[model samples]
Target: MYSLHLINKNIGKFYENIPFSGLTSLRFMIVDENVQDRESLKNVLEFLGYSVVSVAGYTEASKHIRAGENYEFIITAIRSDSCMDFEKFLLSVKDFLEDSSVVIASERAEESCFQSFENDEKIAGAIHKPYKMEELERIIKSVRQ
Candidate 1:
């Protein structure tokens, strides 16, 4: 009993009526030592409608985790100047996060490194640096699923 125009209008209104929080409730935490790379990734993710919090190193990230800030996704670099043992930092915080996916991103990450954490349930995935937006989105979607 509705015309095509009426149906389209209703659909638009339905979507517009939805709250931002309802539409995007997925929270993300990004940890990287490179300022440019960290901000660029954060901007891209935010533009794509995901809530993101970026930190320069492990210490800041640990503070958030310790304070019980729950992030659905945690994207971190494999190496940092301040955090000598990046893998150890990730493993240490695994217990604090409840059902959160930890994705490692680094230019030097290789198949061997991924293989090492393949058995670790906390490690959701890995992405090499210089990745396209599509590649990053694909990884994020896969981890959320």
Candidate 2:
């Protein structure tokens, strides 16, 4: 399949969700602890013609946000060990991402985890990890509507 054609020095990770072709004027920031997932997802999104920035954890994401970097979408996985307080972290960074849609990403079922942020319009929704690049595209499309 595409794995053969896409095998190059620049894209080292195995992309499991790329659907061959697409084009979009969207930007995304993906935060995940697993290097494989983060890079693969970033690669897939990039392949589909989206601007993607992948980071290992919240700490790295904070550096970009603190530096005044903004994106149309922010897909992140929150962990108690890495980010002690999800609410506090979101609150602290809310100003910088007011126009951005925050999508919580996790391998676990995390529908209930984002309840607190329901009042805040910034939260677009939640997308489970290992998600297909198409799923993320859907979320972004919905954000426009």
TM-score of candidate 2 against the unseen true structure: 0.78
Question: What TM-score does model 1 achieve against the real structure?
Answer: 0.77
Model 2 Cα lDDT, one tens digit per residue, 72-132: 8988876633554566667778888957888887788766776756677888877776655
Model 2 local distance difference test score:
0.72
Tell me model 1's lDDT, rounded to 2 decimals.
0.71
lDDT of 1 by residue, 1-145 (tens): 1111111232122111211223267888988988867876676567557799999988889889988999988888887656556777876687898878888887874788778887887777888874345455566567765
Q: Report the Cα lDDT for residue 46, model 1.
A: 70
Candidates' C-alpha lDDT = 0.71, 0.72
Cα distance off (Å), candidate 1, residue 108: 2.5
Q: What residue runs in model 2 are displaced by over 4 Å at the alpha carbon?
A: 1-23, 80-83
